[model samples]
Target: MTTARRKPYGVKGAPYAFLLPATVLFSSFFALPIGYAVWLSFHKVHVFGLGLGKGARSEVWAGVENYTDALTDSELLDGALRVLGYGCIVVPVMLGLALLFALMLDAEKVRLAPFTRLAIFLPYAVPGVVAALLWGFLYLPDVSPFSFVLEKLGLPQPDLLDGGPLYLALSNIAVWGGTGFNMIVIYTSLRAVPAEVYEAAKLDGATPLQIALRIKIPMVASSLVLTFFFSIIATLQVFNEPTTLKPLTNSVSTTWSPLMKVYRDAFGTGDIHQAAAEAVIIALATLVLSFGFLRAANRRDKQEAAG
Candidate 1:
């Protein structure tokens, strides 16, 4: 047998040369910072004497002290629970509305589909902070149109910015901002499906709902999975919306979410070591939740294929 030929040096080097800038950027910007955070997580600053000079403050091994503290902190646990509740409301409602709108757009003989689609997606073009600010004004009692409508109808206008209502208020902002983007994604996937599939289903006398349930949804499962993955990640890292709302309302704390808690530790408290530990834990938790859902989806797909 002839020996396998090797790629020429110049040919082999071309790809690496092309990738050099990205590699350098990734290492400098991404990999190195992650490595540094990991290092910081396992270290603590020890004060010597009055802690006045360079040698006065020394870095020592922490041995998971920060991690243990974070894990056992009731404030962190409460914040996590709050986020879980917020996510429960946001994810389903957002994705459900997205899928519904996408199906409606994909339906034949739909009215003003282009205008409606653009209007639904317009919120996506607004910055998250701006969107939150606008919504915060809408939720305010004095300036809210909803409050005005309720007053006209002789109904009590419930405070949307406090207590349990606060959860719904925040969830609404997230859903409104996110649903349009997800709708566009799902709608794009629906458009990719072959027209022949719909033609055959129609010939077989399947109703629009039946086609949506049996064919359209199944065909767009990959897009749903993709959107779900990103939604979960975004929900976990919720910061901007809540941060924007904090100035408008007293209900939101500095440590409203795990990420906020990390920020509080890092800057507010000047404890980088603890902040790094919390950040790492949050990162690991996100990875675990994401991959766990992906694996479950994969297994379901395999089972469906086997059946």
Candidate 2:
């Protein structure tokens, strides 16, 4: 047998060289900040008598004090509950609409498929802040066309900015912005499915709805899981949409979400240590929930395959 030929000089280092920039950027932007935040999370500042002077405030080890306070804070807990409620509305509605639209797009002889898809997807191109601002204007009784029409029809114009309506209003914004992107994801997955499978189903007397429910949906389960995973993460980190809406309504408090509470602690109250702890907690929760979901999905997939 002939000896294996040696690779060219520096060949072993080529992949590392190519990855060097990305690695450096990741460490600089993501890893370093996370590490620093974790370090800050376990520490607190001690103020000297004057609360003003050189070394007046010094960092000191606080163990889990910051975390304990964060856990006990009613504001943080309330924010988390609000987010959970919002997510309960958002994730299901958004993903359902997305799946529905994708199915409709895939159906035969659908009218205006291209235009409809484009119209549904156009909102994705708009920045979240701008979208919230636009929607915010539309929510105003004085400015909204819906309100204008309600006035013309002599119907009551309810406030969309407060109370139970506020949750729906916020959820609608998220659903509208998210559905199109998710539709694209599911539709792309649907298109990748082998045409032969559908043809075989058709030959076996499967109707469009039957095929969609039985065959198409199953094939795109992976896409659904992916969208769900992302939707959860997005729901948990909801900030910009609600933040943008803040100027338009008084109902949206500064601590509308856990992430928002963290922001309030960090910049609003000048409590970096507490903020860091809250941030770390949110990050950990996100990771735990995300991995737990992924594992469940994987286990289900394995079970199906085994069957």
lDDT of 1 by residue, 67-159 (tens): 998899887888899999999999999999999999999999999989999999999999999999999999999999999999999999999
After superposing candidate 2 on the true structure, give the runs of residues whose Cα lies further than 4 Å from its correct spot. 1-8
lDDT of 2 by residue, 1-307 (tens): 8999988999989999999999999999999999999999999999999889898989999999999999999999999999999999999999999999999999889999999999989888888988899899999999999999999999999999988899999998999899999999999999999899999999999999999999999999999999999999999999988898888889999998898999999999999999999999999999999999999999999999999
Q: Who wins the lDDT comparison?
A: 2
Q: Candidate 1 at residue 82, lDDT? A: 90
Which residue pairs clash within candidate 2?
none
- Candidate 1: worst 10 consecutive residues by lDDT? 4-13
Model 1's alpha-carbon lDDT is 0.94
Tell how far residue 71 is off in model 1, in angstroms: 0.9
lDDT of 1 at 301: 97
RMSD of 1: 3.1
